[model samples]
Target: MPDLGETYACVPSTERGRGILISGDPKSDTILYTNGRSVLMLDLNNPLNVSVYGEHAYPATVARYSPNGEWIASADASGTVRIWGARNDHVLKKEFKVLSGRIDDLQWSPDGMRIVASGDGKGKSFVRAFMWDSGTNVGEFDGHSRRVLSCAFKPTRPFRIVTCGEDFLVNFYEGPPFKFKLSHRDHSNFVNCVRFSPDGSKFISVSSDKKGIVYDGKTGEKIGELSSDDGHKGSIYAVSWSPDSKQVLTVSADKSAKVWEIENSNGKLKKTLTCPGSGGLDDMLVGCLWQNDHLVTVSLGGTISIFSASDLDKAPLQLSGHMKNVTSLVVLKSNPRFILSSSYDGLIVKWIQGIGYGGKLQRKENSQIKCLAAVEEEIVTSGFDNKIWRVSLHGDQCGDANSVDVGSQPKDLSLAILSPELALVTTDSGIVMLHGTKVVSTINVGFAVTASAIAPDGSEAIIGGQDGKLHVYSVQGDSLVEELVLEKHQGAISVIRYSPDFSMFATGDVNREAIVWDRVSREVKLKNMLYHTARINCLAWSPSSTMVATGSLDTCVIIYEIDKPASSRITIKGAHLGGVYGLAFTDDSTVVSSGEDACIRVWRLTPQ
Candidate 1:
């Protein structure tokens, strides 16, 4: 039960990481489209429960509800787009294979009868307009010099369309046999997003060059330019126009959303909305939509922020949940308030200490977390999913964790005491040692050890098994010593830890009991039922060896002092919203804990 905060926020997609945001009818309530394999429709009014639809073979890049609100169209990396009736349980209407490469963006015609899809590949990126019902190509707008990033059809048109691309040009087209009418090259960098105003009189485009331009929809002439100096400091990724067409909204990599008045006033900035989440300019604002006067923006961190144009100063509501599952967790050595988590879908998130809560750094499209080991310098994570991740505090800013992958899926992992040396992973089938990215040794265990721990001196190692046995091995040779086997619990042992002095060892059971043993005599000194309601998942001993902390499925933490009996120890109830999966004591007084609730909690222990 790893905390989700660390793993998800750290590994995110660059362009499509931020999920598509849609608006409900004319009600102004937002509709969020998210998920890796399926399309999830989240209502902004509820924000908690969601409606899911469309099981795709690949991850979805974008989804849009039909203009009439009767259908939804979604595209994926496989160049497939599916149209579904959005009203009745999202029934599938039609599926089409439009391109050979990734489908970047899609838009339904104002009448909800046609779809326009664009993308890039071997040849020129194609913008093909198709009839939704028949999957027949209606027209093709084929003059983009590079991959197309976005495309949209004018709301009221004798069939007018706009397409933006990596070539930094916004191409305008017209007709049922759509032909390129004009190409606006005002954007300095890749034009990321473009949309025609509701009235079809104006169009707005955003780019990676930290600028946005408002152009006449018909003439394709740039009328106004919004620069970083006008309140944005980073690349602008998305732009939207208000319903009345008098205001424009833009989201940027600057981590803020700004609204500009289209009225004839010396071009002054109107409203600026800073994201509520704690992130710097690099946390990209990638998706946005304006429904009525309310503005909704989405970031690379997976959190959606909503603001009202009328009240920019008020704090916006934030949405949080997992689009994936947790994989691993590692506690920081220097800062008990910080923890790293990785997910099965390859997302990494960093949790930092805060007043009543903690801040998070979520990266999208990261490799899955495989194994985790904490050291003084950083927390290292390796995955069968093919990635070696590092969360370091000294070098780069504590914004997002970085990762690299070795050749294969990591079966097991451990860190060596020696600098620049990494231990090779051994599997349950065979015991092998990998050093310097190469296999060095192979040994066989009578029974497979699922979990292992290296001694502080690096001279000895202890491996635990599913057979309820502990095998102690000497690092110098393959020889092993069978330690005392105390068989009180009926289930397999989940976790084991050695004290700082190596004099005492603790073993937790699947039945929620902990047994403290004297290492030399191999005698069980204490048998404590710490969690009566749930199984114990992890255990940790204080640095001073005065107390022991145990995390359990009951969502509670208990501190057992060596001098005090287990029954009389201090208990911290409700330590995590979900079952606590891991715990670490940085010192005698500070403890860090992570769990399935997607949160890491830090507590201070004093003589009370």
Candidate 2:
């Protein structure tokens, strides 16, 4: 038998979001789900590869395997539910509208004969059990005054069902006719999840009130309430019983997961696992599941941390990919071994060094990164969500990304090595020179800047803005001496990069052009319309500065030579199935790009 942890295709929660649940078929060794717009069937035993489920109009919220393990049912924020066969050769079995609001959860009957329950958002919540074979409604259970959160049906004979919602009621129903039996209002807050034990002896309910309760399987009567004196500190989001029913595991917003011993006189907590909370906005624990003997926890920042009940010292494994839109990427200059990425939802992932490129990913603090710049052994990231973060790369145990408040939203950043004595950072509001953590000087740019870059020598810096012009500022003494406004692009400049020797610099614009300028004269040496079909997302200069690479919204990567015409550049079409969003050039011959496809592709360039 495969370990239950092996069946999760994708874990969506982030460090601050919630605890993660690893759900799928251990029998098939497959975790069926979706990543972004594509559905995927991942082989948990061998996670390096996966099968794609193509594209959807919106991002997927939940995916589950049918009881017979023949089909997968998935729902999205658009309230669209799709049923597709599990086999790669199978086709779409059904596609239908479930609600006008976001679908929170969906479940199929144990026999795979029908999809018993589905729910949507807010006051529009509806519980309708439908026949799968005929695609017809069988029964409707209604009474909740708020959004339905979770629903489940009994696995065995009695055919009883239960649902919990924002109305703070756990409603019970009996029969194939499915009538409301009773509504329990013991919880003070929203009920998030409900599930029955595998043997149908008991059912577990978790709520935002920070409590987990056990109920009798035969009747809806409460058996016992589990409290934080047992180890949890915040609202519990999810709960699952051990396969043998000996223990119950609950994930909480307090940044911990607790395991409770059921046979004890008071239902004692056997162990408590404290998850390292991400500073900034990434502190929520959202989802969790007990898979086989291991406890799998997920957070809002998209970190999947796996722990063993037997060994409490450390997590055995951690998995990470995408939980939201990837916004920025930076490759280490000295070592092409690692890549740093920032997501729109405020997750920073370090794709570490390794062979076959299957290196591990380390998620940093849970805050949206606005800009990132690497200096020597430290990587500094600024967030519009507030706080400037500094992360060290000197330790064996990956150092946590630590943040400090700079009292303003940093819109852009650039690093310059000024005579081995100073380093500077340019922001939307001002220019700041740093000596370690202390700010030595500040120059107000007086405009909302969007892009910035430092010359190779670090003596000069340029800031671009919504004003459609570039401001060249020369660092002198402790302040900016003066500013020169250069030729403006038709649209705002999005990114800027300098040549290795500081002799030249390039700025990428929203108008799909990359303008290269001479360092001393500030003369426009070249103007290349690299992305004719779409906006240029990013641009990277090769190590020698002889070649430049640009990624665009057209899902293509174009390599341009300084000496060649823009029409004669080398273009790799479909560099990413979706539009390329980030680009990094490793040395003079290699380039890497990450796209909306959630993949980073490496390409080798040769001078022609």
Residue 150, candidate 1: alpha-carbon lDDT: 88
In order, candidate lDDTs are 0.66, 0.68
Worst 10 residues of 1 by lDDT: 2-11
Give each prediction's root-mean-square deviation over alpha carbons: 10.8, 6.3
Candidate 1 wrong stretches, greater than 4 Å: 1-28, 227-231, 264-267, 321-325, 328-448, 451-608
**lDDT score of residue 183 within candidate 1:** 84
Residue-level lDDT tens digits of model 1 in 211-262: 7777877776778876446757766777888888877888877788888877
Candidate 2 residue lDDT tens string, 1-608: 10111111233533333333335665665655455666666554455455656445787766778878888877777877778888866578888777677666677877887675446644564676776666687666877877677878787778778888788889888877788888899899888888887777778788888878778776888888775576566778787777787788787777677888876323578888767644433445577666565676666655556677667677546666655545577777667766666655555566653322222234366567667666557777777765666777662224766655655677666666444234555565776766555678777778877787766566667888776688887766677755688875877887788887678888887777788888888887777555547777788888788877888888788887877777778887776555877777756777767777665555666556
Q: What is the TM-score (0 to 1) of candidate 2?
A: 0.75
Q: Indicate the residue-level lDDT of 584 in model 1.
A: 76
The positional error of residue 152 in candidate 1, measured at the CA in angstroms, is 1.2
TM-score of each: 0.59, 0.75
